[model samples]
Target chain A: MTKPVLHLQPRVKTMISNATLEQASYEIMKKAAIDIPEDYLAGIKSVAAKESEQLSGFVIKTMINNYEAATEDRRPMCADTGLPRYYVKVGDHARFDGGFTGMERAMRSATARATIDVPLRPNRVHPLWRTDNNNNVGINSPEVEWSFEPDADWIDITTVHKGGLFGTDYRMLFPGDGIDGIKRFLLDTLISFGKRGLCCQPAIIGIGLGGSKDTCMQLGKQAACLRVVGNRNPDPKIAELEVELKDVANGIGMGPMGFVGSSMAVDLHIEVGHTHTGGMPISVHTFCLSSRRATARIHADDTIEYRTDPMWFTPYYRRETVIWENT
Target chain B: MLNKVNLDLPASPDDIAKLAIGSIVFLNGIVYTAREGVYNKVLVDGRELPDDLTSRSNVNFHCSPAASKNENGEFHIGGVTATASFRFSKYLAQWLDLTNTKIVIGKGGMPVNDYKNILAPRGAVYLTTVGYGTGALLGRGVQSVDAVHWLNELGIAQALWIFKVKNFGPFLVDSDLQGNSLFAQQGELINQNVEGLYDGLKEPALHRYGETGNRKDELM
Candidate 1:
């Protein structure tokens, strides 16, 4: 059977210079390393205000102080200024002056520049040979994932700082296991690796359910990167599951820093998708309390604007807010 | 059992033994920064301890600090990231036994049984530092960083650093010389709660996904 072809209108062409894009990438990386996003800042404040445990409160206060100090001193919020990971949305209408490879070169240069400018700790090392690149621009380092937006004329780039401390995990379950199996896997993961391990209590839990292993893992990454701490899935069932998981996770009494506390996780965000009848794959990714991210949009006219939130996995709605002036 | 105390480096075994699991301590004097590379070098490769390291009370840190050099070529430590302790437990235990190290400062829990059997018996304790407050902790507590060693081979991530500190903690005695571990206790409580929740659910029937399903089961 032949697939049906749909007629589509042509998109307006927009030429973006390599130099301009590279400069924008450098600025975004520098800011992300030094400053915690405003949304994350607000979440930390809210959690601190509600904290009842003495030790937990003290730790939260210190974290708040650390944020302020990092901003004022122009130093990294955490010592582990993690490996740079860019999630980019390139518009179909956008054309790079030097093509896709040109854009790749721009990103690589930007990463190397940010390493020294932000003075990010050189965390990249040869996996087997154990060689230090010093500037974090090694083999397959500065991971970038690309997606396309039809009919758009600008490119949107979101930089997520994934620290070395909080690690990622994935699991595959049979259809027979059902939601019960998911709950067990999630709870077990939290008990063993959450509060103390990487999720680091008061963490933002991102759960990806269904689909293939890779797809589920990507979904999990997106879920973990929700704009705000308490953002819920649009689907009611999944949203409710998030709330239940949050409550159950907090019930463990790990508290902030895994000491005694009432708040274990600030929020849980679950992203769901359809899977094959025989199998279900689940991936859990965590953003620690720091939850550092920054985003920027490059327009058709070569004007760049920094966004407060990337709003990944959703439609890009333009807001009136811009942090950096057009360059 | 939460007592606020100040402990001087090279502390006596009696002083360490008196510390309970919940005791909060402020560490004073010198602490050495040692990570996996340092462990591999000193313990695995059988390298001799530097005179400066052995002369001081062995209060080692499981951290790889972020530092930058000034125009004068002197390094200014901006912050410290505490690595997970479990990754280097065996080497840490061996190093402690060899050096009579009084304390090991790190984040995330280590092997409690091993610490109790090896570290505690050797007159040492495991201290837990604030994991996320790396910047604040370093900026406020650490007075100076000097006498760095092994930079040529390990780079910054695993180099040995000697830090002069003053009132450098709000550390919890997670594993004490009395053979008690705060992490072990918490793990027990967490395990009990999780197991109880799982116990009420009916077991799911077995099913397989993909050609590699059997391999996946073994891996999990």
Candidate 2:
């Protein structure tokens, strides 16, 4: 005996995509460029004189190089070959055609193809021995972080990148309350720690404020891709702090690659959390100049849309100015 | 202001094989890429490599050679970083010997004693970038991945090496002429500062009435 397949009016849809390794990653790199707004580029110039000159040629060249390489070779632009990370922004009206494990399988296919196609340097070695195992794949390789939003149409898929390379950002640990305690770590980070930690690129600073130690770090990395290029925190106190820190960072005399540039940090994005009665933990994760990321909208209609030009997504380059500040 | 300078440079694979043990390079040209995880699966299990891989000739690309572009328009290049391989510096030295790789880029000077001999024989060079500066260096437009060696079964963000490169940057010799690395100096300075402060604390003249321990010891 055989069971009959059910056929009815379609109320929802699902997409199980498997791109060649290189093809999938190339798509992600394209979207990262469009996500950064034109106004944000202008605003960065307004605050810092150096950005105007440096960003002019810098952003375009980066995008062209990033898009071309990623598309042509089907590999990631920077080699941190970051931890296999995924962001799923799902629509409420839609339902997965298959169960949880099935979705995992689809994403896994995408990641595997990216691994082979992108040819990212496998980052995970045994934590202890540090052996160079050849497989770029790992347990929980493509980490899927999901967010369900109330929306019609269908689910949207976007590639969110936080550079996986070492010293890609700054991490500040708060032991307890004291001016000296925080100052000491802050200064050290800006000095050798910042130099070594940031690897000497103009970076966006992700500040994890008032959270559990681990959450603080997560907030910093998660926020790394958020806070649109030229946007600011709504909180007044945080906004002021961002301004003050920018000034102090520029004062560090750490030029380009820590040699001597106008400002080592581009901007600081700070996120706060509830602290223990006695302690506070703060950290900073720096995103390198490449700032590689992109977004793709996989609609329910089987239409794959890219927000940025998948063929060429440029970084910030010198351009006309437009400022947008909302506090 | 953009300052441009061009110099014809020769990179000896042997020298780089030696120097890269404890140095980082600001690379920007077609360079090969590999990840530890992928190798572990394939080599250990006798897995099949992707088509046209060895013929692609990764060895010449891996070492410090002058810039070259693969068939793909993208340049194969990169600034050196803390490649997890620094921990396997010894094994990679042997790998480089087999591969004929001439240049390597990354941060954190590798341990000099580990593979100076391996590098010297090949005449390769190791280059270092400032740590935490991948963004700045990459932003400067050095290397972009060109062609890649694929182990497709592997997943996203896990490819072996997406080969590419463009501009090349500076790799300061943090190690001394004798191959002593500068990282130690920085690390030592930090250790000394903390140690000295601990030793320099003066005794608290007066003690708290409900003190759990002696004031002098706790304060110090």
**Per-candidate fnat, comma-separated:** 0.33, 0.05
Candidate 2 regions with alpha-carbon error over 4 angstroms: A1-26, A29-75, A125-136, A151-154, A168-184, A196-200, A300-302, A308-327, B1-105, B108-126, B129-220
lDDT of 2 by residue, A145-230 (tens): 66654444454455554555443333333343343443333444555434433343456666666567787776666554545454
Best by DockQ: 1
Q: What's the residue-level lDDT of A120 in candidate 1? A: 72
User: In candidate 2 chain A, where is summed lDDT lowest over 10 consecutive residues?
Assistant: A311-320
Tens-place lDDT digits, model 1, residues A123-219: 8889998898777788997888887776778888888877754547787777777778877777766755655545555677788888788889988
User: What TM-score does each model's chain B reach against the true chain B?
Assistant: 0.86, 0.54
lDDT of 1: 0.75
Worst 10 residues of 2 chain B by lDDT: B59-68
- lDDT (Cα, 0-100) at B149 in candidate 1: 87
Q: Over the full model, what C-alpha lDDT does candidate 2 score relative to the true structure?
A: 0.45
